[model samples]
Target: MRNPLDENKLEGHLRSVAAAGCQITLQDLEGYRPQTQPSTTSLEYESQYKLLVQRLVRSFSLEQLTQVLELYHLQPPPKPTKRKCARSIVEQEWNWPSLADVRRKKIDSEFSSQTFPLARHVSFLLLGKDGSQLRQLSLRHNVHVSFSDRPLSLKAEGLSGSLRLLEQDVKDFMAGITQETFALPVKRTISLASIQHISRTSGAFLETVDSQKLRIFYNKSHPHTLVLAKELIMQGLCQVTNLYI
Candidate 1:
């Protein structure tokens, strides 16, 4: 016959070991006998089980802990502290899975990426002369931007919705810079057809200055775009000048 008194003594020893943060294994309970009056013993064992669970949970990193809670479909704790999160998991009585399994099923649905092919000069302006603009853009949009000099492109990564908003903002910035005005003084008789062709090719609007000069207007909101527009207009003007010279 198994000794109930010996079982009690073993339970006490296990409790002390648990309290001291030592891992308790099923093998430790191998020789222990079950009690006939099992109610008290069952309750005590339940307490030890929970204690062991908490110790196991605390061993996880904060990120891992949160992931486990999410895998179990539990609401976030009100305080978001590690202790509270672990306690919430315990209180819910959910079965805990291994960390590898939790990570294997982790969802990354919210993340996305976008790329923009920016000209070298345009990239310089967008990122600013000192890179301050790039920093501010990242902070404002809660996204990360990476630059590639060979292709001269900007790649942004973040939540899907934020990426959409960032794309629109970048397009607007490019449009604004392309809208600068270029003035060309009338030295020789310039053909209206030539001016119209320049407008079509450069994607800029043309205005006559009291029949004395011609001005090209780009989208015009950005100072850098003004410089770029002037360069574009000058290239077209050179062709027009050659035609009449």
Candidate 2:
């Protein structure tokens, strides 16, 4: 016997079930057995199926929709687009808190260079004291103290190399010291000829040099070593562009 119901009629049945709030399950539908009419084309069957789905959606409540979607493992509809807020638009326009601004804020801390005094850019090293093995003196220029195996080494990392003298020199200077402290004045004046000679010999371009102030830090009352350092300064052995104690 030929099946009498077509795809359209089956769609109508589905709409009626949904409108009456009559719940239907997959098992019930499978048992009911939808029958296509003998005259129904393949395209017509597909169209009717789509219409059935659309009508069912329009008639079902939120709860029914949720249950149906869950039963079928279907994805929910996409969320609606959100409207732009005034503050967000303003922030986009201003573009504050840039990378540089953030970095500056972070670096501008209590221990920043601006808060601390300016020190000379020099190397720091730890070596032995006693002034023995003078070759061990080859250290980073910024080192003021000795950190070595020698127990006699003084902790003078805070002092400058200009203030340091050889052990023999210190001994000789100490012999004549009656006062507590001694000061040696160095002349700031440098002749143009001397500058040219230094530039040629040391391969230092004088034109790019900024400040040339001679600075010396040494032990107080060490007159012998002080005079020796002063003579070296006079002879242009080392150029103190900027000296800081």
Best by the lDDT measure: 1
The 0-to-1 C-alpha lDDT of every candidate, in the order given, reads: 0.59, 0.36
In the range 43-148, model 1's lDDT, one tens digit per residue, is 3545544554555444544454466566667788776776666666654633334333333333233788989899644575576535776888888889999998
TM-score of each: 0.32, 0.21
- Model 1 segments more than 4 A misplaced: 1-109, 179-219, 222-245
Instruction: Tell me the lDDT of model 1 at 189.
Output: 39
